[model samples]
Target: MTAVTDQDHTDQAGDAGSENREGPVEEPVGGDADRGGKDGHTRVESAKGGPARAEAGPGRARAEAGPARGETVENAEGQADADSAGGWDDGLIARRVTAETEQAAAVEVRGPNAPPAAPLAYDAPLHSRLDALRELVGLSRARLDSRTLAEAGQVLDEAAARRRLSGQHTVVAIAGATGSGKSQLFNALAGVAISETGVRRPTTAAPIACSWSDGSASLIERLGIPPRLRRRPLQSAESEAQLRGLVLVDLPDHDSAAVQHREHVDRILALVDAVIWVVDPEKYADAMLHERYLRPMAGHAEVMFVVLNQIDRLPGEAAEQVLDDLRRLLDEDGIALGEYGESGATVLALSALTGDGIGELREALGQFVAERGAPARRIAADVDAAAWRLRPVYATGRRTGLSEEARDDFAARLADAVGATAAGEAAERAWLRNANRACGTPWLRLWRWYQDRREPPTGRLPLRAHPEEEATARQRVEQAVRTLADRASAGLPAPWAQAVREAAVRGSQGLPEALDELTARAGLPPGRPPRPGWWPAAVLAQASMTLLQIVGGLWLVGQIVGVMAPNLGVPVLLMVAGIIGGPLVEWSCRMAARGPARRYGVEAERRLREAASGCGRARVLDPVAAELLRYREVREQYSRVVGV
Candidate 1:
């Protein structure tokens, strides 16, 4: 039989040693149960009470006695040992168990430590962190919505990119009256023969842009220049370097007799960021330019250059004084200049032909471009000016909501003024009475029975009776609307007032036609039929009744004569009663006709009210509705800007 190593013995003890005794055992090192000897090896005894077996190497040997039941031993190499010594060696077994405990303690202290197990499940802490970040993002989005900051963000982004791309470009537009020499200054500044400088007033029809090679082509494109008028790139080195990124514009004359040229100047002035207002000695103080353009552009304080051109014509000292006067005028017009302790405008003197201050002007322009970076703020000012001009068009106040009680009161007052309720009830009653009259005797008798069954009138009816010829209620309503419109427009300027008046006139133009249509639709009596003289109808009816009464009276007298001795006084009394009663009955019928006539008057008043309400809705309320729509659009744009 092959000898079992100490490692084999420990392995056999762990796996029940019967197979180990039958064959050579291949036990794992440091896997021992009974290696309690000093060399860290253990010995095991055979089951037949043989000597304790000494295992080779540094491991315990397996015993043939199958680990001696409960006896346990250990090796010094920090492994569990299983072994047996017969004859009740309890103390020895206890010592062996203590040795195994010490070995395990040593192994725990010295062995390679296992890394912490990889997180087998999702990390709750990491998920919580992500949730916190998501909440922060949501809050930021909500803040943006509340303030309309998103639009500001977009504008800032566009402006920043534009600034990054725009270099030393200084865009200067020449704006002036018809004979202001704006084109001459533009050509002088450009140092080239680019624009059409002429002697005729309002020479420049369209805006012309001249730029040095170093200037921005994209900016010129953004100005919406057509190909033919676009100037060729300047190639002179000194001109190119000094005027690098300089965009000089010769704009159309603003005070031209031709409306198209004036409009062109106005449009380009509104779009360009910087304006060099070119004024000559003659028309420098023109009130038309001051009122039409300069006053309206009061908000465009930035990037404004007021140039007194054609100074060559004036005496040298007089030119300085003229510039000072012009600056004072600009101040009075509310254009604040930085040189005068304000933040924005500038005034300069220049002679385009003499080129007296051209170098200084160019140097100042370059400095402006360098210091200000770009004209973004000026462009924003232009936009604001345009928006300001449009504000009056949308300055309507909201319609106040009336209380329910007020509405009811207004309706009642209007109804009473136009007699609507009385008219409606009267129309129904009149139709009923007319039907009764048109019916023959049986229906008339029925109507009388119905009326007799009801209660009698306590006094006059609740509403006053309408007159035979009703008042002009439709005309009154139209006049009221007109008066209200006039009051609403009383404080407006002439142009605005005129616009309101035109709108009102247009709105009411169709009123007469509408009233005619309403009258036709209502089926009211178009006009009154001519009545015969009252005496004629009265005489006819009375004569017929009298004839009947006389015939009856004569018959009755004859009957009485046959029956008994007839008295002559009875015949006379019967004839007199017949004649008098006939006229009385005729008078009673005529009195009864008054009620039907009053009902017709009521219906005429109702027709008038209906026409008034229709006109009010179409002319007054409809125009107000359209104006409100325009106001809403302006409000939306304003809100977008102010972050409301």
Candidate 2:
């Protein structure tokens, strides 16, 4: 039933003197003064926490807009409100100076765009979830494309930041369509014309804010309000004494024809702690208001309020009917009431012009201010909204890494390209070739030695000797990696799928060279057949045969010349037996070499396959698999964020 405005200095000073004779009296609310308010309600006394004033004494305390260093505002009970706030004053923008008294603290005009003071209260689980999200962002930023849920991520970041700045300042944005008496309601609450009101269409082009305390400079600045829009030459008024810790903002009309005005409303809606939707009898259930703002915000019902302003125009019975109709529309729009949705919105009826029903509105605000739970509830709702946006990425069941069958197929493809099978064959051939020389007839061994000394080392075997073949092998390795990535990301959301693709080839930029190098180092083992433990015995037997041949040849020559006994039949017989024994010993050694050759070939194939698989794992599959794990981990964290 009152409005604070320009007051003469003489009257204000005289009133201040009279008020000092009678100090502030704390009345007993509950029957027992000791309990304060036992009915679950607290009568919040307006505590002093603004810029420092002279120590409370018998007369009015001297006023200052911004206190000097180390000045603290202590209440009559010696309880502290803001002790460590001198740092915020340095960042404060131009605020209008004001006067004050000992009973009522001087309320100064804060810089419209000043930063916030003091962070939100301690929340353990909240901090844990925050830490988990930071980890997800850091680990997956480079690995995944982070576009689809960008808004959600941004909301989380800003929310955490705002809470860090100041939890005590509850930013309640009053929003409504044109001709909704929105600005009038704001002025009525603030007890001053802080927001412009008139017959002009789409007035209040920008948001206007009026706070009850002085420590929320940073929060005001963060809302993007400019300094020019704030009220000037502020004063301490008695009408605003009941509501402290409240920062009321009059936002631009949501249904304005001006696009910038609508944009402003939309932007501020995302940052506020609570929302008050102002409507009048004329457009109480306007479809534009309900569809554009209310229905879309169904999940934020807990922090919402529907004010049916200009009710004085309706007759008592008509007002009831209109109020009922408005309730139906709110139900349709899903906007709830009460500080925490204790019941259906008690659709408040008021007349900003007539000043009727204003007391009830003030009481509702007083309770909201006293409870101090709206900020927390509003923040919680914001998280819920953000979580809803990310449901598509996390709602489905978790996806694991590349399956076993796929990995094996991929490895097999790379092994073929690396010429592991070719190396195995070369090993077999080389073992057999050496065995031929080791066990061949002693006389023919001389011809084999001549051939071995002439061939180049590479031409000696058919083991991946072409550059064209090596290039093809590299391509095959890269392709296998791509296939695995595509299969793993199938059916996932686009961002996650894109992330998988990026991760799949993350380390593959150097894959071609890497594969070529790996293949080059996987050379076949030595071509010589390993000399068996019994090689000496076999060689000795062959040498003995050779000696017999030599001796026989000499004897035969002597007999033919008739120089010695011509009937020496034993010499011819010894030469024929030695020739037959040499072939028999050579055949046995070649047979024994077959088993060793097969074993050596198998070993060569294994070594090449191992080397090729190592390259595939490093350049392709590992990054993709890491991205999949990150997805699963973030999905788990999203569930925790929603408190599901």
Candidate 3:
């Protein structure tokens, strides 16, 4: 292989001059000695140069006619290798579009010195795009409508199968309705009658392939063609050499009366790299072809050719009129015609019997075959169509992620559902009741105990919910989940939104019970909070006051029985002081207990609320967040696929 240098690019550009070129043609493969002259990178002997270099001539100019190629081939060490330049990335879409667009315009129309065509590359590589589509489909399969994604899946499967086969051979299928002379045209293109053709309504019952070169067996087999049905060109050496690397398939009549024949046509058409629709003047505007296939496959203009075959039946300009009318119909069907050499659907007129316009068709096909880009172009178009179909699901009005406020609201709801606040209030009341029992006046305490003895004893403070509170708690939990789902799914597509909703619902099951369990295990202080030392002192003081009261009462009884001398009412004063002081001590203890009771209640509430929030996050918010994360990942993949 010869080393391509900067001069070679310049020479190629100079040769291109001011005219655009058609499809790119690959440089002929040869040994190093055959490629390089005396110089390492030169093809022709130069007087000023050290070695001979290749020059771009009229015939060889088309091979290098695209935009000055900016892309390079690299070796394992990441260095550019001119020897491998023609192998990798040859039949890619960017190159094809550049070549076709240049060929479509004139130098006069597109300025004389129009800058070299801008490099066009896939937004993402083909494999990456396909992988994105596969993952998107897998994730969305259960959530989305199956019918909507079926086309994308089919595109993925077909692309994989086609890419696995031979990249050297371009498979072109000749498809047409019955009695449309498609078989005749197929035989005409192959330069031999390899496919059977007759006056029968469906002459071609099965597809037959004719290859112009070797190494296409896998491709033929992929099309489901049996060995017996596959044939070679069997034409003159020159004819075979001209159409090298082309695998022409003659498909069954698409409009055949036989269901199997029509099925065969449709099946083969989908797998073929390019399709040549051979229509006669009579059925050129057939509704079946336009409605069913052409309109639906409008995006595949790069790999489509609409041939008005059998134009010999029409007189002089009638054929031209029909061709113009056909172009109009194709436009209406949304197929872009490759007018003025543009890179789009190629439409032409020809007759297999008369041989008129046959040379022009052959010339165009030769350019197409020489390029070996039809398969890549077809696959790229399929990807574009699939991506377009999937646009709605991926395109969002705004971000639909879970919000912080929403999470906080959910946690609060769960806390309420488990009755954390109510439990705290109960704790405060329990502390107050215990304090009153321990420090109240002795006689009063006795009287209260005797009064409560008649009623059943309540074992423990009521920390859990009553039956009615339990029902209310359940409702609160359900509402929290519902609100979270609504917030998370806002502005999302129907499928993704529904998936988020389902995720929230799935994680919410058993959540209320789980929160209740968490509250129970919240490690709250069990009975009355740890007693303060001052509580004991208060209790002793109350006992002393009670003693004083008893002493004063005994003395009064003695005086009444006349067992003692006259007193100055000391017993009465002592009784009055004891009575006032005891009530005052009890009131002081009650006031002091308020601070500790409030602190203890707050601690209990904190523990319960913390546990409830953590539970809610694990059971509900975490799952919802996971789902949202998945959506974000898939959205990024979708952007890569769409080249956003």
Give the Å error, residue 277, model 3: 1.6
> What TM-score, over all chains together, does every model reach?
0.39, 0.65, 0.66
Which lDDT tens digits does candidate 2 get at residues 539-579? Answer: 78777777788888888998999887986688988788778
Clashing pairs in 2: 113-221, 114-217, 114-218, 114-221, 115-217, 115-218, 115-219, 116-218, 116-219
lDDT, residue 263, model 3: 86
User: What stretches of model 3 exceed 4 Å from their correct place?
Assistant: 1-124, 134-157, 196-198, 234-242, 311-325, 339-343, 384-401, 431-460, 463-468, 479-509, 530-599, 627-644
- Summarize candidate 3's per-residue lDDT along 251-297 as a digit string, tens digits: 88888888988888888888888999999988999999999889989
Worst 10 residues of 1 by lDDT: 102-111
Which regions in candidate 1 have their CA more than 4 angstroms from the true location? Answer: 1-170, 175-188, 191-208, 213-244, 251-271, 280-301, 309-316, 332-334, 351-356, 370-393, 396-408, 414-644
Consecutive 10-residue window with the lowest summed lDDT within model 2: 26-35
The CA lDDT at 546 in model 1 is: 65
lDDT of 1 by residue, 1-644 (tens): 11222333444455433222321221211222334434332234343223335353465443343233222221111222344322322221111111111111000000112122111121343233223323322333421242433333433433343444444465668888877888777756754434555565556776666655322445555555532244432235565556666666677778778787777676666545588888988888999988887877777767877888889999859998888889888988888776856577778888888898777787777666556433655545533443344345323353322234433343343344455665566554554444333222333445776885695422122232344323454454456556545654554433344555556567766554464455445434432322324535555555565665676587666867696456666656656666666646544655655555555556556665665465555765466445333334434554333223
In candidate 2, stretches whose alpha carbon ends up further than 4 angstroms from where it belongs are 1-119, 134-161, 164-169, 181-244, 258-264, 280-287, 308-367, 386-400, 403-408, 443-462, 466-471, 484-510, 525-529, 537-584, 616-644
